[model samples]
Every structure is written in structure tokens, then in C-alpha cells.
Target: MLGIKTVFTEMLGIDYPIIGAPMFLVSYEELAVAVSRAGGLGTIPLPNYRTLADLKKALESIRKATDKPIGVNIHLSGKFPWKEQLALCLDYGVRFFLTALGDPRLIANEVHACGGKVFAGVVSLEQGLRARNCGVDGLVAVGAGGGGHCGSIPALILVPYLKEKVGLPVIAAGGISTGAQMAAAIAVGACAVIVGTRLIATSEARAAQAYKDAVIAAGPEDIVVTDRITGNPASWLAKSIEKVEKQPQLGSKRWLDIWSAGQSVAQVGEIKPAGEIIKDMAREYSEVCRCLKNTLVP
Candidate 1:
């Protein structure tokens, strides 16, 4: 029955405690702005940009599209200019940052100095504590069932675990695609939820039609984890596993064609616009909360 007034939503200035989790090439300006305009936090992934110019253009595009605050995800792989990316995003008015795969201390410090909030995308309890020590404003507890680089533990256990130990606002990620799932995350002490796979099927997402089709055709059983793509454990489509393995190199076009999605894709029935998706989720959320409120009265 939790409303829009949560630590996560209030801090991010969003109407819903939902974030469109950033995806490598799938998240872009259009999708990001769409989600932001629909009352959730939309995020731009740094990896999606091929160069600094591309990043700048995308940021400018998003700014022109929505006046609401937006977020950017920086994957600390040391493969990109992390500092430069941060500076560029800052200049473009990005106030919320999501960090993954490395120590967030430097990023957190820099962002905090500029009155920005830093959220560390953590796959485990240890990572959550580490992010907190780095002075991150919040934690994104990515569970085992999440898309991309995910954790070994499930959200049902991880959310409450971080809630007890990290002492920061927790954004539960993984296996959350609907309002009922969002309510479940909040019930377990998460201040908000991050949705990725569902957004991939949105019209604004940059994912190829084949990729979106694969996600639509998939069920929970079709979601599997593999280390072939990024040399790290990441969730992907079982159907694409063979195709990815057939690629001679990791960067091969065939490999790039492979798609990744979470178990929640099973619940996604069609490809809609990102704004419509968020609106539907918000409506469902309110209805779910009202139903829960009635239950409490009885």
C-alpha cells in the first residue's frame, strides 16, 4: 500500500519508485526520456555510446525531450573514460547516477559534491555494504534473476538482507515487471524497484526487432545465465546461447546480435511504447495499493 512518497522517489524527484534499468545498447535517449516523462526514472547507459560525442548528443536529446530529472548508468569496466563520462553527464544535468562493476567511492564523492545522488548496482550483500562505505546515497540490489550482470541471490532474500545491513534506500532489481511485483518488492522493504527486461520490449528501446521478438517469445525457462558475452555471469536467452557460442570472437556481429533478458519477460505480452508501459504500471500500482489498503482495514 506504499504510495509515491518513498525515500527513493523523493530523492529522485520521481512520481513512481521505479527505474528503467539501463541496458548496454538497449537503453538510449528516446527510451530514457519516455520513462522519465511517464513518472519513472529513465536511465542512459554509458556503454551505449560509441564515443564522447555520441554521449553528448544523446544527453542533449534527452534534455530536449524531457524536463524531468534523468539518470545515467556507468559500468566501471575501465574500458571507457569514467571520469570524463561523469563530467559530461554532470554538465548535461544528470542528477542521479548508477554505478556497477567497480569501486564507487570516487564517483560517489564527486557526485555528492555536486548535489547528485549515487546508487551502486550491487549483486550481493558484500557489494551493498561496500557501496555504502563508498558513501553512495543508495543501493540497487540486483538479484540473481536480473538481466545483465546479476547476483547469485534472489530478490526476495537480497532486498531484506540489504535493508537490514546496508542502512540505505534499496532499489530491488530482478524478477520485477508488474505492479504486483513492485508491491512485492516494497513489501520486502525495498524503497523502489528497477525493471530492465520488460523495458527492452518497449518501442522506444534500441534493441533490434529480432531481439525484442526473442524476448517476447521467451518464458521464465528461456532465461539463462552465461559468461560467454562479457566474460562475466549475465542473464541471456537460452535460444540465443547457441548462436552466441558459434561466434568466433566475442565482438563478432553474430555475438552482438545475441539478446539478453530477465525471467520477467515471460509476463510481457506485447511491445508497447515506454510511456505507455510506465503509465500502465503506475495505474496498476495505485490499484494494487488500494486493494492492499482495503485488506488492512479488514
Candidate 2:
């Protein structure tokens, strides 16, 4: 097995250290299954769900896809009850969780009660430390290229910097797309990696074809950091940006009208299946590791 030798792999029961972030619209059971089958943890973002039953059904669907370890993402600040998801997770044996957008301490005790582990996302040293203090098992140190309400610095800086500041495992995200990039993340003190935009371009992404096309066609400069995507700061494709910029004269565009992610929007070129992408990244990483060891020793 291609083990990562890290807490992420150990806790999540996966081989690769990579994880599929809980992308709002694109993340679902299919994507999660594909990711898990490829040796990484997959996540379902539950903030978009309006009711407990909605989340319940989503979890059921995820179970239908794969029996491997899968994660559930929680918006800590939302009124939605974490208790509900927590109950379901325990009942269904879901243990790995990526908690974001609020206080990790708020839910840590409850999650741990269910024998679940938490990996919380942060943008700064302070935030990372806070999560540690709150008893998070690890950190998802979201950096510059991360999508959907992200941080300002690059992952390279954030991951290493946070590692020095805290004692927990770190999973770096934002702008990581390829196996080479995943290798770079681990080399920089990250124990694992989480990818969002890369999965967005995948065949199983639950997005409109036009949205997928827009992401593939985007360039770095074509992306815009817009607060309009949701009630938070997030990156958008230029088309979404233009639509926001045009701002619709007669009436305003609602949060529901925009597409969003982090600054990593331009890194992916095509949408393959999530399973395919995860498997390919792992295979490529294995090959690269072998090549590097041979070149260095010979």
C-alpha cells in the first residue's frame, strides 16, 4: 500500500495523505467514493443542505458508493445542528470529519464523544493554534490558492509556518492539483493534502457543464475574489466575476447566482472522474518517489 506515515492516513484509514475537500456544490457521494477508492479521504459538505433529512439522504447516498472511510464537513457557525450530523455519523460509523468556518472548540467534545476525529481548516497561525487548543486532531492549513472563503498566504508558507507554530498534523490545501504538487506539500511540512478545484473539474462533479467548462477555461488572472458567491470571501471564475461585475443594473445578484471556490481555480485543465483523479495522483506520486530516490542515491 502507498501509505503516508501520517496521522491523516492512520486516522482516516487511507493510504495516500490526500483528501477531497467538502466542495459545496460539487462534493457528493460519487466524488467521495472515487476519492476513497483512490486511497484518500473524501468529504461531504453539509452547509448547503437545508434539513437534517437532506443530510441524512446525502450520507445514505455516500454509503451506497463506498464503504471506505469518508468525512463530513461542518460549518461550525451555522444554525444547522452538528448534533444531527454527529448522531447520523455515529449511527453510520462515520468518524473522520473536516470542521471549518467557525470555532472547533464548539463541537470538539461532542465529536470526540462519537469516537470521531476532527481536522479543522485555518488561514493564519493564530487560527491554527486556536484549533489545536480546541482539541482538533489535526489542521487543514488552507492557504492562498484554496477556494470558497480562503486565506491570503500561499500553502507553501502557511503549511510550514503553521507546523512550526503548532504540534498537530497539517493537511495543506489551496492551489494543489497534481501529484507533484502533493509531493511538494508533504515536503513543506504538511502531513497530507486536500484538493477542491481539482475535483471540481472532475467528471463526477455535481456542477453544470457550463460551470465545468468555465473552470477549465480559466487562467490565474481570470479569477476574482468575490464576496458575492456566498456570505463569505471566495474565489470565482471570470465569467462569474463578470456577471458580478456587471452587477445587474435593474436588480442585484443574490448569493445563489454565483459560482465560487478558492484561488486555485486555474490549476486544473479537465474534469475527470474523482476516482480517476485520485488514483492517478497516487500512481504518479508513487512513481515520482521511486524516481527521486533512484536519482539521489545513484
Candidate 3:
């Protein structure tokens, strides 16, 4: 197996500098476990569980499936009982957390107290600096073309910009789906890459079969960034956008059928097991490195 090392892998005790980027309805125990078992970090979004018991059960299930490092994703701005969710996850021995949408100061302190790490999602240099000031261990740079709420900067620029400005280990997210893309991100100083839209096409993801098919069918042109669904600018399949535009009555339930995906959807051709996805990515990354060396040296 080809193993790639970075600050992320060392900090999270994983084999590859990759994370199964946490998705709202898509990421769960099965997906997380599969990614973790395949040598990358896996994370379950806290909002996926309605109650603490459900979250606990999911955590327990993941623990039984693999001893590899797993993380919990918390939407810090959500209305859910995040404080209690954080406490429960900590009690269950979770050492890694991914936070987004709000101040991470409190969460960072709590997690750090237990010798855990908290990586917050940031779309700009300002957000990155705020997260750093809030005591986060690292940043997940959500750049343009990312599936969910993302920023205007492209990963190629955002990764290096954040790396230069923030001085925290940055996990590049957005516009990345293949091993070559992963290598590009690392080459630009990203400590890791987060696989979201590509992972949704994986068999282990909890997304509906229709949603997976939609993702495979989508091209970069088929993706559109809009704030209609979540009140935050997020990329979605154009077909989904059309559906929502026509029905208008789905309201809160719109997200259930209105799928979110990044521009990387163009690269996803088929559904495979999550572990296979990770392994393939790692192999591709290695091959890309080899090719780069061969082509550039001569």
C-alpha cells in the first residue's frame, strides 16, 4: 500500500492525509468506519443524529467496527444541542472534532482539555485567523466548488493562501476528487484533502441511490452555487435546483431531495465501496507523484 504522510495524518494518527469530509445527511457510522478502516480519517456529522442516544449508538457502532481514528462534525451555529452533543462525544472518548459555522473557542478549549484536536472549517483568511485565535488545532479550508457552504476562493489559491497566512495545518476541501488533485493540494502546502462529493458516490455513504446516481450524472456545468436552500451559498446539482424552483412548497424538506454536490461530481463515474475509494485515491496519489517526478526532472 502506498502511504502518504502529512501533519494531518500525524496529528490524527491516520495513515493517509485524507478525511472523508463530513456531509449532513450523507456521512454516518458506516461511511466513517469504512474510510477509517481504509487508512483515512472518517467523521460523522453531529446533526445527522436527532438525539444524544442516537449519536451515542452511532459512535459505539463505529468503535466496534474499527479502532482507527474517527471524528465528529459539529455545526456550531445549528440549533441542535451541540453543547450536550460535544459532552457526550467527549465522554465516549472521541479525540477529534470538525466544527463549522460558529465560534470554536469553547469547543476548542473543551476538546483540548481532554488532549483532543478540533479542526474548524473556514472559507477565508479572516475566518481562518478567527479559528486560530479561538484555539482550533487546524483548519478545513472550504474553498470554491465545495459541495456545502463554501467560499469564493479556489482551493489552488485558498490552500496556499491559508497555509501562508494562518500558519495552521490546512485540510484542503473543494474541487478535489482524484488522486492527482489530492497531490496538487499537498503540493500547494495543504496538510490534507477532504473528500466530500466524491465520497457521496461511495457505496458506504448513506445517501439515497437516486442521489448517488444524480451525482454520477452531474458535470461541472451541472453544478450551481446558490443560497436558496440553506441560506448559505452552497453548490447543488442544477437538476435539484430546478426541482426546488418548480415546487417551492417543499420548504424545509427541500434539502431531502435537493442534492448538494461539488464541481468534482464531474469526476465521479460510479459507485464503489468507501474503502475502495480511499485505496484508489492513495494509489492514484502515488502514481501521480511518480509521474510528476519523471516528467519534471527530465
Candidate 4:
């Protein structure tokens, strides 16, 4: 079994150091439940909910499926009515939150007041420090090669930097899709690895079949970072680029018509259930650790 202890695991009360990163539209009740049931943190992306009732229903569904702790991801932009959504989540008994896109200070304070843990998604050292100062419990250090909006730095450098500089548990996000990569993240100081693209290909994910197919067929070179989709730097398939190339205005384009995936898409060769994926990762993690341990001279 893959087991490790860190502030992240302790705070979330999860066994495995893996997080099914909240992806808009893709992350919903089923996927979250599967991840939580598999002993990893499962997160519902708030944007997937059209209203407070929708969010509550999803939360209820997740509760029905698993007894494990559940988390919600809220994009911290002015247009999202994030305060209202946060209050709704609190009412629904959500104790873990991951915020991105804007200042997390206000949200962190509110969540902290309610005894909830808040983790800020950051791409750069400056953002990590800012999140720490905002009283966030930890940081999701999303680096280049991550699926959505990500920083230019690689996790190889960013994870340790944030762990050393921020003095908090840092969850590495980017280009991680296998047990070896998970081990690599921990070796570099991350408390866990936030998986995005890998989960997209999972059975529980709500993404379209075509999107999942595209990801399954992709390679590292096929993942392109483009700002045209959400007006922020995010990784997407080359086909997504081609789809949006002729659109005169970004507003005229349909967001999900194309697909987003990280450089790790190459590692996702098959579509499996969310729980099975976690177990596979755990098995691979154990094997990798065992192999590495044999290399040491007594």
C-alpha cells in the first residue's frame, strides 16, 4: 500500500497522498466520491454547479457514496459569487476548500473562522507567499505542464521552493500521472500530487467521450498552453487550438467544445474507474519505492 504522512494528509484525513484536482465541468459528485472512497482527496469544482441547490445536491450525492472528507474548489474571481458559494458549502458541511485566480485572504479568513482548511492554488513563489500570508492552510503549487491555468516553472523546481519558502505543506500539480512521478514529487518536498489530466480519462469523470479519447491519444508534445480559452494560460490539446483559431472573439467560442489536458496526458493510456486508477497508482508507488530502496548499500 502507498502510505505517507504529512500536514496535507493529516488535515484531510486521507491515506494516499493523491488529490483528484477539481476540474471545471469534469469534476462532479461521482468522481469525487470515488476518489474519497479510494483514500485520496476528492474535490468538486464549484463552477460545475449552476446554483446553490445544484451544489448542495452534489454534496449530498458525494456523502451518500463515501464517508471520507470531501473538498470543493472555488475559482476566486469577482464574477463567480464565490462568497455565496462558500457559505453554501459551509452549510453543506464542507471543511476543505481550494481557491484560485484571485486573492484568497478573505475566503481563507472566512473558511478558517468556520474551522475549515483552505488551500490556495499558486503558480509562482510570489503567489505562494501571498497565499501563506493570507492564512491559507497550505498551497497547491501548480507548475507548468499542469492542465489548466499554471505557472511557468516546473514542479521539479517549484515544489521544493514553495516547501522551503512558504513553510507549509505544498501539493505539487503538473505533469504527474504515475507512481514514479508521485514518488518524484514527494522526493522533491511535496506533501502530495494533485492529479488533473490523469483523472480526466477516468470513468467517473463527466468529460465528454471525445475529450477523454483525445487525452488518451495525446503525448507531451500534443499538449499546448494557450490563453485564448479562459483568458489565462492553460494547457489544451492541439485540436483545441485548431478549433479556437478561427474564432474572431473568445466570447463566441464554446469552452468545453475543445479539451484541456496536461503534459501527463501521454501517461494516461487507458480509461479506468477513478478508484482503480488510485489503486494502480498506489501499487506502482509501492513498487517504485521498493526498487529504490534496493539500490542503497547497507
Please, what is the TM-score per model? 0.94, 0.91, 0.96, 0.94
Residue pair clashes in candidate 2: 146-174, 146-262, 147-261, 147-262, 148-261, 148-262, 201-271, 203-272
Off by over 4 Å in 2: 1-3, 228-231, 244-254, 294-298
State which candidate has the highest lDDT: 3
lDDT value, candidate 4, whole model: 0.86
Q: Tens digit of lDDT per residue, candidate 3, span 152-190?
A: 999989989988999989989998888999999999999
For candidate 4, write residues 254-285 as lDDT tens digits: 67577888999879999999998887887898
Local lDDT at 12 for model 2: 69
Instruction: Provide the lowest-lDDT 10-residue window in model 2.
Output: 249-258
- Which 10 consecutive positions of candidate 1 have the poorest summed lDDT? 247-256
Which window of ten consecutive residues has the lowest lDDT sum in model 3?
Answer: 100-109
Encode model 2's per-residue lDDT on 1-298: one tens digit a residue: 3655676777767888888988887787778888887778888887757788887887888777778888888877667787676788767768877887677777778778877888888888888888888899988888875777778888999999988889788889888878888878888888889888888888777877878887888777777775655666677765776675567662553344466655566667777888888877777777777777888853
Off by over 4 Å in 3: 248-252
Report lDDT (CA) for all predictions: 0.87, 0.79, 0.89, 0.86
Ranking by TM-score: 3, 1, 4, 2
Steric clashes per prediction? 0, 8, 0, 0
**lDDT agreement of model 2 with the native:** 0.79
Q: Model 3: which residue pairs collide?
A: none
TM-score of predicted structure 1: 0.94
Q: Candidate 2 vs. truth: CA RMSD?
A: 2.2
